[model samples]
Target chain A: MSLQRLAIAACLLPGLVACVNSTVDQMVFNTPGAGIGDASVVILGRRHASDYETEPEFIRCVGNHISSRDKSIGVVGEQEFLDALYPWFEPRTAPLRPADLERLLEHRDVARAFTTMQTRYMIWIDGSTVRNDSAGSMTCGIGPGGAGCFGFGTWSNDANYEATIWDFSKRAEVGRISTTASGQSYMPAVVVPIPIIAPVQGTACDSIGDQLLEFLSAEY
Target chain B: MSGSMTIGPDRWLAATLLVFLLAGCGTKQVLVQSEFPPPVMNKLPLTIGVWYDEEFANHEFFDEAAGRAETSWLVNTGQAQVQLWDTLLKGMFRDVVYMNGKPGPGQMNPVVDAVLLPAVDELQYAIPAHTNVKVYEIWMRYRLQLVTTGGAPIADWTMPAYGKTPTAFMQSDEGAVRLAAIVALRDAGAHFASTFTSIPDVAQWLASLPRAGDAARRRVQP
Candidate 1:
């Protein structure tokens, strides 16, 4: 066989059943000082919108990724922060802007608890990943002899997210970061169905985490 | 004689019929329970008392959607309601006293500066029957009335709270509803703590209190 034919055949060996495409876009209005100290950060999902609510697991995924990458910085769980502050940080009462934070800190209890936490940055994430596009279907049947699935099925998911970073210590809006990720998954069956899944939301989380690390950290 | 006996069609028919007959439950009773954290806010420095009536104490909503085969849901918010309000009133006021009966011309009541009454006005729940995602949601409307110690009306306001399960995957219907109700209760606490002074009548009433002169100056604050 020709070299070109062999190369093409090699590419097709894995069936090319799964692929993911993702992008990260960030804007920095101000940078941090030298080196990140023992300050902590909270990655919270915004759920004020009436039509949709940010998935709680997605916020945890991003927090896990950020914390796992750097051991020096402390990452507070979304529920922990919300529960600690109680009604203050709940969806309906959360501060939407840096100025709101200033007002929120006017209260003695809110200011005392918030300032003592050493939370330097508040990252608000808003968005979700949805299976927007899909086509094809698989049919399965069970009989007295055997059961098998036949046909080719494929689907695609789109993920869009935005991160608004607030420097709580400074009471200022530092920057904004957004990510978009799309992935395609495919399933094919001769007698046995070979299913392939795409990591659509995971990709989005990775992009957001990387951008956040760069946006918030002074070193690494 | 043969050791094996032949089975008759009657037995097979009876067994098949038994397999198809399912003992399905017609109703689902969800006794909602949840914990509430103390809110962060400036306390209104007026001695207050709350009275929970029989209907408000055992609040339950029976939801039977129209023209669906779904099981009827009886979500009892009584326990959680008392717990939430008890905690919330404590966080918002300098002192809280739970009274046994309503204040009236003849009824015996506590010597509080004001009395707060909270009742569930309406509750609605929805579950995904045809939607792609399996999510359970609940919305609650509360009628809150503030009255003087003599049962004279100070301010009456309506507040709404909403909550939904993050995801229903791998969760039972009862568990999902429980979580949803908990979330809704928390949402109510948040709303009350943050927006109590935002209501015009409530703010006016708060400002009218002798100890709330400072509150009157900040009544217009967001």
Candidate 2:
């Protein structure tokens, strides 16, 4: 019986590894100066293309995490940022280039609008985390009175994100934080299936948010 | 024999269940931060007024079928082109003074030596469906005109830029298009800058401008 248990444990080792294994890779660019005292920054998710449709959770998660972690720098909510940039959200227009930014700042109304927001910096988060390389499957069936799912399946997720920090005062990109996380997930079943889900998006948010705080804070 | 068979099925079911319980793991978002490169500066001390058509500047590309202006890649591309022109020109020129309107008579600023007007003639892309080895091609065309503040035409040229990128199984079509547009615009901008200085009309106009020292001396002595 002990030998049999050992064999079963060997069979399940890979799945166990899949459930617990996760890796985070990050790179930091220039850090914001410490002297900018009490100036607020807004975190925005780029809405171009299908980004708005796919990456809201990750965006919101990062924003929430950053706000919760750092007490010194104020965080602007996503809706407030959008409200300040109203009418500029038209999907047909191109992403603002550096020159367009200068032009925008020069415009009386637009300048006044941004000035009213009192945001010194803008952090644009772009990219997505998605499920990839899914293999194996489980089957579900319904009986006369009840239904249950039984089967085995496994999948992996890939998370890629880049946070670009734009200094509104300087009208330039001051820093960038980019990260990629990839890990495996599995679902196993006997009579009742047990799903071992990977918190890929959540992990990304935490990692990014922590690093962002480190990058923005004077201590780090 | 029946007991042995029942044991075999039971073991298999348990193994399957173990596997299911152990699976379903994924990576979360990780962030890596690094120092960004410093901004590049231009050597030439030239200040030009930049302007774009108001209608074109605010125009959004609308998708009639989707009934949404937001999904159109062309819109972003168009907007990106305007920004690209501004960025590239700023890097090439010492000062870029943005003007609200075309530099017509009395519309030009007295401080600027010349004015540059960039108008979008066409912005488009092609990505056909149901094809292997997906190819996205973005075409951008611009009408660039340079005129002196006094309304004398210096040079006028029509520039076209093209960007092409491939898509595989996992790549996003939107990302491919955006990248292609960026590539096309960068190419077009580089071509324009490299060729603009060589144009006879532009060369003559630039050559005619007084030297900085001469102007400074006059200012100081006067």
Candidate 3:
């Protein structure tokens, strides 16, 4: 009985080690040069919580995103336009200066989270705009040519995803990333999950993030 | 919101004002600080250049269909896209030094050092110092495109969009087209000094040097 017990213990140890190694690997894999340990990932956008009526699949995908990673990713949306988009989105906009966007990035806490062990990464999704043909705006619904059109009653469509990463310590643009897609009206529009890892020529948000992480991690 | 203030030796001529053209039109302007200058002896020279590290050649625009278009479009039509990108680059070197409470002692507009630095390379500022006092040298080069609907060649009106009457489409704001030019002395002033040292030697410092911002700041103040 004692010999049998020892054999079982030896068999289980490797599996446990593999689990531990896998967790660490995933963390390191997600962020190539992220200063090791847990890094806080903050997703700032107009939408936060999932909406079944409007974006059911998106809502489901967000839940899957949160569960996949051990790090925390919070959403903020205090601006007038942002408040209306997400259910749990917390609205936040820095005191923007008149000089330039570079100056605007200098505002403390705009990108970096100093208190936590993790660093702060911000993603800004552009706000949606209404479509009106008379004033030269995009249409809300379908057109006679089978193209997308927007009427007065419909809400404005969302802007492309433009993610800009900043290092609080450096106080300069460490990484800036943006995303956009085209199709007829909103039908053609699609929002991919964050940390898009495609290595293709186009539609590669993950690759952009990966490259930025690599640069930040590189020893100068 | 539109607002203006009068400033200058000839107060009547000075219509210093700011007006917001449009919101979310992919353009913005902000006040660094509020302070008046003595008088305009000369306008500051704006230095514009694509640093060796920056990817200027393979530059691309935002394709409505492409996901990566936003990154290209923003950088392309960015603040640097305008003629003023050079001006602001030069302006950063002008008045304030790091941690100093006052603007540089010499003329703020036309810094002698900026006028001299561009002479080192063709990619640097090409124009010689202007002879006139009021008119500043506006040396500008920008990437642009003339997009038109498919049509026959017409000396007078080649495109259908250009009917008998001229329209706004004729004056396209296509990707960084005509970035623009302006002659004015702008200073972020002493408040911004804490973040910078002094504008150091422009030519000597290679792009490879680390903490170059610190080096530049140390040399900026006279």
Candidate 4:
């Protein structure tokens, strides 16, 4: 009788199952449009070039220095470069037709999403991946009581952007924006440096909005 | 006369002692027993793994003519993952779910699998002694991709980690502390992957303990 009772209790249990929740936090975003008047410019988010990994972290880091006007301007340019690309989209008109393809490319929102502020433009961060391979290690200065401690030096502060966009009913692109930045706060070294500096990407949707502003400025 | 006085003093002393004894009682230790019990382990076994794909979402832009569309769309599995995963051993791991197919609406990007706790395999998790008030290590690998509803590949990318969990100190119960720590760590990792740091605080760790329904019934009958 006792053996039978034990078996019955075992069968009643819910069975062992562990469900771990996802830990990766994410945000959605869309790139906006940019250009001067009436040209109907759009700005889209695009990953840096495949070789973006080759970007110099130190140079990018130098650009993040708030005290250094040069660095600040450089970061602005990096953001601006990203802001210039138009968002990517697939055409809805089904069936293989040349007209559909032309219309797709000609779609004002779609066209504006990819073009830069001006026809003759440049991209400073042509390399893939924003910073150097060992970029994140500069948080601690040379030694204790160090003067002009450059923990999280130029290479330590770099930002990258990855985004997607979906068209809104209002003839605009709306989506989530996800942003991530790198700096001293991202470092794993001891002697946590103060006044952390880093690079960041906005949400996909918010970035789209920013891009829209850039595209409209360039086109109109 | 002296002998009588001594006897009288002895009698008086005995009377005082008797009165003091009558007024005395032992002090009590008032051990107010609590109602809760220590936490118990509910072991659960789970498996995890990765999915592979050929394209990522943006690949649609590679041929803008073929990629532009107006329909409300979700990315297919292949376009969904990162590239680091192309190299892991192909096997079913417990506790990890890689994004391998289309995501549901309102789902965030960089799709992830659900977490598996306790664990199916003994080799999957390790709990170091006093590592933290509630710290556990989980090891598993997965591939990521997105697939359309009709079974077409959409995007592809793979990420794989060896030996240790790709991300650590995840899903902690540190409340506001956890959020602040993540922000700080994100910045640190950006500058130097090696310098990213977080230390668990043991003093303030809290877990809700189990409580008994009937304390009076549990007391050992004397």
Model number with the top lDDT: 1
Each model's lDDT comes to 0.82, 0.61, 0.26, 0.27
Write candidate 2's Cα lDDT for A47-161 as tens digits. 4542122254566787778667666767778755654543232223223553456744533545776777677877888777667788887788855467778778988877778
Model 3 lDDT, full chain set: 0.26
lDDT of 4 by residue, B1-222 (tens): 355434675587689879876534322111111111111111112222333333332222110122222112111112211221221111111144554443445534343322111111111222222132222222222332333323333333332221211112233222222222222222211221111111111001111112321221122111
Where in model 2 is the C-alpha error above 4 Å? A1-29, A33-36, A47-54, A89-99, B1-222
lDDT of model 1, residue A143: 61
Predicted candidate 4 versus true structure: per-residue lDDT over A24-142, tens digit per residue: 12343433343222222122222222222222232233233311322112123443332232111111111122233243343343345434232221112111223334453453333
TM-score of chain A, every prediction, order shown:
0.87, 0.79, 0.33, 0.23
- Report residue B72 deviation for candidate 1 (angstroms): 2.2
Candidate scoring better on DockQ of 1 and 2: 1
**What's each prediction's TM-score?**
0.85, 0.46, 0.22, 0.19
Ranking by lDDT: 1, 2, 4, 3
Clashing pairs in 1: none
User: Interface-residue RMSD per candidate?
Assistant: 2.2, 14.8, 21.2, 26.2
Q: How accurate is candidate 4 locally (lDDT)?
A: 0.27
Name the regions of candidate 1 deviating beyond 4 angstroms.
A1-17, A139-152, A189-193, B1-25, B130-135, B211-222
Which of the numbered candidates is closest to the native, going by highest DockQ? Answer: 1
What's the DockQ for every one of the candidates? 0.52, 0.02, 0.02, 0.01
Q: After superposition, how far is residue B177 of candidate 3 from its true place, in Å?
A: 41
RMSD, one per candidate, in order = 5.8, 16.0, 24.3, 30.6
Give the least accurate 10-residue stretch of model 2 chain B, judged by summed lDDT: B29-38
**Model 1 chain A, poorest ten-residue lDDT window?**
A9-18
